[model samples]
Target: MSAELRRELSRLDTLANALDSQFRIPGIGMRIGWDGILGLVPGVGDAVTLLPAAYLLYKGHRLGARRMTLMQMALNSGIDLAIGAVPLLGDLFDIGFKANKRNVALLRRDIEARIEEVA
Candidate 1:
C-alpha cells in the first residue's frame, strides 16, 4: 500500500478508543471523559479497541516501523486488553487511561525520530 494509505490506516487505528471516550470533553474542551462506559460491553468493547490497534500494527509494518516500536504497540494493546477485561477495575482503568491515545503518541514519536535520523 501507498505511504498515504498507511498513514490513513494509522489514523483509523486510533478510533476504537475514540468512540469509547471523547478525547476532549464536549463543549468545554476539557480533556477528560466517561470512557469507562465502553468496558460494559465485555468482548465487543475490547474488540472495538483491538481492531484499530491491529490496523495500526499492519500499517506500521508497511511503513517500516522498527521492531521495538511494533513491540511497543503490542504491549500497549496487551495492557489495554488486560485492564479492560476485569470488572469494575476495568471500567476505572479505561476511564483513567487512554491506551489508544498513548499508542498514537508512540507512533508520532517514532515518526519524528525516524525523520530526525534521516535528516
Candidate 2:
C-alpha cells in the first residue's frame, strides 16, 4: 500500500481501537473503550459515536470500496446505532458490538484487496 493509505489506515485503526477496546476488565480479561463509556449518556452518546463510524464509512467510499462492502459497513454502524440507543442494554451492546472496529477492519480489507489488484 502507499504510504498515505498506510498512514490513513493506521490512524483509523488507532481511533477505532481507542474507541472500542482500550480498557480492560479487572478480572474477566474483557475490554471496552470510549464507546462503552460514552454510551452511558443515553440518546446523545450513541449519536455522537455515530459520527466517527460514519467517517469511517465515508473513508471506505473514498477509497473505492465496493458497494457491497460499503453497505456492510453501513449495516454494522446502523445495527450499533439502533441497538445502542436503548438504555442499559445499549451500553452492553456497544461494549460488544465494536462497530468502529468492524468498520475499520472492512476498510482495511478493501484497501488491501485494491493493492493486490494493482499489483
Candidate 3:
C-alpha cells in the first residue's frame, strides 16, 4: 500500500478503536468504547456518535471505494443507528455492533482488493 493509504488506514483504525474498543471492562474483560458510553444517553447519544461514522463513509468515498462497498458501509451505520436508538438493548448492541470498526474493515478490504486488481 502507498504511504498515504497506509496513513489513512492508520487514522481510520485509531478512530474505530476509540469508538468501539478503547477500554476493557473489569473482571469479565469485555471491551467497550465511546460509542457504548455515549449510547447510554437517551434520545441523542446514538445521533451524536453518528458523526464519526459519517466521517468514515466520507473517507471511504474519498479513498475510491467501490459503490457497493460504500453502500454496505452505509448500511452498517444505518443498522447500528436504527437499532442503537433502543433503550437498554441499544447500549448492549453498541458494545457488540461496533459500526465504525466494521466500516473501517470494510473500507480496508475494498481498498486492498482494488489495489490487488491493479497490480
Strongest candidate by lDDT: 3
Local error of candidate 3 at residue 23 (angstroms): 0.8
Model 1 gets an lDDT of: 0.67
Candidate 2 or 1, higher lDDT: 2
For all candidates, what are the clash counts? 0, 0, 0
Model 3 score (lDDT)? 0.94
Model 2 clash number? 0
Question: In model 2, where do residues sit more than 4 Å from their true spots?
Answer: none
The reply for model 3, stretches above 4 Å from the true place, is none
Candidate 3, residue 27: lDDT: 100
Per-model CA lDDT versus the true structure? 0.67, 0.89, 0.94
lDDT of 2: 0.89
| Per-residue C-alpha lDDT of model 1 across residues 16-109, encoded as one tens digit per residue | 3564455665696545333345567876776665776687678667767788988998897788778888877886677666776666667767
Cα lDDT tens digits, model 2, 47-69, are 88888888888888888898888
Off by over 4 Å in 1: 1-20, 23-36
TM-score of 2: 0.93
- Give per-residue CA lDDT, model 3, range 12-115, as digits (tens): 99999999999999998989999889999998889999999999999999999999999999999999998899999989999998999999999999999999
